[model samples]
Target: MQIEIVEVLDQERAMVAFNSPVGSAAGVWKGGQGLETGTHHVEFEIPDEVHSWSLVQPTHGAITGGGARGGDFVTVHGQVEGVGEDSVVTLRIGPDVIFVEMEDSVERLNQGDYVTFNSPTVEIYPYQT
Candidate 1:
């Protein structure tokens, strides 16, 4: 159930939509990790943080953010130090080390992958001039 961040709708709320495989796979994304992944056209409201976000354009992926309410699911993104050891993926967001579980068990995230921890990430969408 690997998905790609497709659009940014409400920046203030950190609301966004990600595109996943059609059918049941899509449902899996919306239901787990407290990420509360949304269905088609569903906008997820990403919780906020006390610190300001640092943004940059990724060479290969898009960005999104969320945090678990009162929990450690902080909105973090950085180069993947490693990924998926039976459902857990580790990310290094600056000086902090963060761990994320792959709710969508089918997807394979890899090392050196750049993920969120910043806002307004510059995504170069394929477009027509």
Candidate 2:
């Protein structure tokens, strides 16, 4: 699978639309930190495939100001079903993903440069084996 960049809103945020060769559908991502504030919209070309994707919420995780904690890591564990499709993915900040002490409209998330969300303080780390 491959993720293509459709648009970049700014240095902190971007608007990306994805395509999957396995299927003839597309997904769009909008809103995130350094961008605008509000309920960002993600329109899927295949509404029928909505259920095809799954969401993984963060388990027990923590982020600290100092490296003394070793490294701040958030694990979004879940499976992607539907066999084949270029999943146009988007990251949303629900109560489950946000800290109780966080009062920012945009919170930092753990997504890559291709992913987008409306959070001000997210640091994306790759999975290491």
Candidate 3:
């Protein structure tokens, strides 16, 4: 997994992007039709008081018999590095920390900021390469 700091929105908000090499293509196709290709963008907004954050990947559901069917869930963990003079902090996703820096700003963000990371349609196709 690789983490890239795309931009920092403020002391409390930052734009972080995540990319992981796809190890397999067993389920790369959606509805067993189209190819999936794209990097998953995960953004984080650290509160003024929070030094670290841990979030779980949201679940997807399918409708069956007029009801909803739920999918599996995964948990993702992250830590906070102190804000730098550039107002940007880069942290790695795996056990070892590799840094990537991006732009920074001071604008406030709402729930929309978090939703970007939880987008289910975003896909990555490794077999194409």
lDDT of 2 by residue, 1-129 (tens): 222333332443332222222211112233334333222223222122222222234432222121111222211222211121243334322211321121222123224211111222232211212
lDDT of 3 by residue, 15-118 (tens): 11223331111111122232123443322222222222333343221111100112221122223333344434433233323222324231222221211111
Work out the TM-score per prediction.
0.32, 0.18, 0.22
Best by TM-score: 1
Tell me the lDDT of model 1 at 64: 31
Supply candidate 3's per-residue lDDT for 98: 21
Candidate 1 residue lDDT tens string, 29-103: 233223433323332222222134333345333223322222223333456678665655565544434454444
In order of lDDT, best first, we have: 1, 2, 3
Rank list by TM-score: 1, 3, 2
Residue 112's lDDT within candidate 1 is: 69
Could you give me the TM-score of model 1 versus the true structure?
A: 0.32
lDDT of 2: 0.25
Candidate 2: clashing residue pairs, number: 9
Candidate 1 Cα RMSD after full superposition onto the native fold (Å):
14.8
Q: What is the lDDT of residue 70 in candidate 2?
A: 20
